[model samples]
Target chain A: MKVAILGMGSVGKGVASVLSSKDLGVMVTGVADSRSGLIDPDGINIGALLATKRSTGLCGSAGITAMDVVRGAPYDILIEVTPTDAVSGEPALTHIRTALTMGRHVVTSNKGPIVHALHALRSLAASKGTSIRYEATVAGAIPIMHTLADGLAGNEVLALYGVLNGTCNYILTRMAAEGLTYEQALLEAREMGYAEADPTYDVKGIDAAIKLVILANTIWGTSSCLKDVEVRGIDLVTLDALQLAEDQGCTIRLIAEADPSNRILRVSPRILRSRHPLVTEGTLNAITLVTDLAGEITLMGKGAGSVETASAIIGDLLAIRSRYGRCD
Target chain B: MKLEMRDAPGQLVAALKPISDLGGNIIAVIHQRDPGSRSEVLGVQIVLDLPQDRLSDLTDLIRSQGVNILRVNEERLLCTRAVIMIGHLIHTDLGGTVDAIDRTGFAEVTGLTIRMPAIDQRSSARFTIRSVNREHMEDAIAILRTVAREKGLLMIEPMGVSQ
Candidate 1:
């Protein structure tokens, strides 16, 4: 399949490298960074593109922009990996819309577009007779969307509960394991590259809330936005509270839950037992899908990283190829 | 098809010769003989890949051998639906209710979960039924409704519309 990648970040670079290394029957026709893009109808040289990015810090030269790749590039699937703008859901949203309007399938890892405009974009893709897959959006490399949409096809999902955000989970784990203060744990997390310099979204629960909204929309076909969630992050979770919970054979975890029957969605730091399925340390994520036929099925895996996220992107690409044959 | 034949030498071979003579490729043959039963009949179930035109001839040949045909299933269940039933499930014979759906040939109960708080109080169960298509699903629901009414139970349909 001829594919175009928009966003030459870690995830994008990882996807390009995987496509180059593996014979997944896919060709990278175009690639873009924030400022520039590279497009060739006959499939761009992935090795040369990576070398160019490494040497000059950009994927394309002058006169080539992301808009050009979206509109003019000859490809069947558009892979949108742009940085998320939670408030606007911009550039990524528009790029996806344009690609679907032009009758092309879309695979994305960006959460903003899906969280904000999932219903609208899904309707557009359906009307256009295409598909949009974002397996890496919620929990990186988890394949939760595929599990719900395809793996459990005949089963009805009654509820979903998960530990989706890695940054907060890392901070909480550190504070509990080391008996360190919240500030010290956050500092250690930043030093370890787990927490961003500006960790407002992760610490204040906005990130997990966004993920919950995406899960709700995908699983239940609900048009739930970020504002609909009752958000409560790990900002106030203290070492004292952790110790207290530990004393009670429990640990604190930022849990995101969605109950479609009651239309309830929330993310909060809850006290979980030591043996609970959702309790995991470090940058790991776990989700339990309570379904009618499958009972409670729990899946756990790495939630983020360049190579891991690329694994999910490649999975989406293969799923598309299996559904629709490789582009001629 | 499933069948029963008299337990004797060559009885098992006799049950399958008709299918082969009618140009059917045998996929599987399950033969179990119960010597303890008074009738001494052996249970035999066979799966065959036979042409559509020869099905009648094959059945005629099998019946001519005095073999009793138990079931003739031609369609496979492809769609699924889940419903909740409440009100004294165990007391009303939940197993019989499940058996009624499973015997429909087009629908079968695939999953079941029961919740009971007390011995004599009302109980609830969530059961999933898979069928061949939408029409079969409706028929299954109608059967469940009839069973529920006869047993003084209530059926709670799923909230989301069928996709």
Candidate 2:
């Protein structure tokens, strides 16, 4: 299978590196980014790209560029890795829509497109007889989407909720354990590289909203628009609130949920007592899904990072390849 | 409406039947699942699908039976605003940061989150608020920024707009 990478950002590079390391039948054909990219239909050198990027942040940035190669050959899969707008999540929406319209299967880690344009994008994919697999969008490395879409495919989901944002969970967990105030926890989190230079989406619950939309759309088979979700950030949590919750044997966690009835979607920080796995610590993500047949099933693991998320995207690619092979 | 009838079985139904008899739809019923459940103050959030002209008569008719309408408030979904807060949002004072914004009457911090790898590491938080108006939203952000500065934390607004 020939794959075309849209951006050579952190996640994109991780995808390319994983594909190259496994020596799977998959080959990267074209790479594109804001900067110029190289395209070799015969298969580009993934190792060479990594080396260039390691030396200088610029080289191997994207697998393809605005400029096309002399041959003008198209790729089977177009991975869109554009930057996400934390607020409206726009341009990413435009890029993914265009790619799907062009009849290319898209796999992205960009939450902007998946969260805001789920209905339109899925409809376009169906119209074009292609799929948009985004395993790495939420829970970074964990296959939360696949768990709901495939593993629990046999059950009717009653309620789906979780601590989807690693950043928030980390801050809360720290506050719970060390009695650190929110500011102290945040300072610690920034030094650890779990947050962006500007960590708006992760902190405000917008990041969790993106993941929630993906789950709601996959489970309900309805368009879960971003605007519909009831969102609450942890910004209101105070040392007193944390102390109060702790005194009651509870801790605060930024949670996201999808409720089909009343068109309700909730994302906020709520106090959880002991025995709730969500109250646990540091960069860990846990999801609880209430189903008619399965009851409540919970899974937890590393929620972010390059290698972990990249591995997820690659795993998704392998699943596609395994099922459809050259046909896909 | 104030209905001072004995809190008995189906008393609500008996009281409500009069409203229906007069072609009045019960917009809300504020009764304790246990009238003794939480001190006789049963609160229900509701909306009526009646024209303003009929509302007065409906209230008058129900009040004649002694059913108390403690307080009637409009039920509407609040507007939400996105805010990016920077500082030791995760470490130094995340809860305080949220509190500063939440305390602002015009806006309430509906969402607050921080990200980082370790507790010892520094991090920032993004805040989402629901307010009645745009000015309320700005005021809330200003409060957060002020608190952040006091804590010796950097305040970054993630909208990508320089503050």
Report DockQ per prediction, comma-separated.
0.01, 0.03
Residue-level lDDT for A58 in candidate 1: 93
lDDT of 1 by residue, A194-295 (tens): 899999999988998998889988888888888899776777655655664565577778888888775668787766677888899898999989899989
lDDT of 1 at B59: 82
Which residue segments of model 2 deviate by more than 4 Å? A60-73, A86-90, B1-163
Q: What is the lDDT of residue A216 in candidate 2?
A: 83
- Those runs of model 1 whose alpha carbons end farther than 4 Å from true positions after fitting are B1-163
Q: What is the TM-score of chain A alone in each candidate?
A: 0.98, 0.91
Count backbone clashes in candidate 1.
0
* Total clashing pairs for each candidate: 0, 57
User: What shift in Å separates residue A122 of candidate 1 from its native position after superposition?
Assistant: 1.5
TM-score to true structure, per model: 0.67, 0.64
Per-residue alpha-carbon lDDT of model 2 for A95-186, expressed as tens digits? 66666777777788878777777777888999998878888888878788778778988899877778899999888878878888878888
lDDT of 1 at B162: 25
How far residue A263's Cα lies from its native spot in candidate 1, in Å, is 3.8
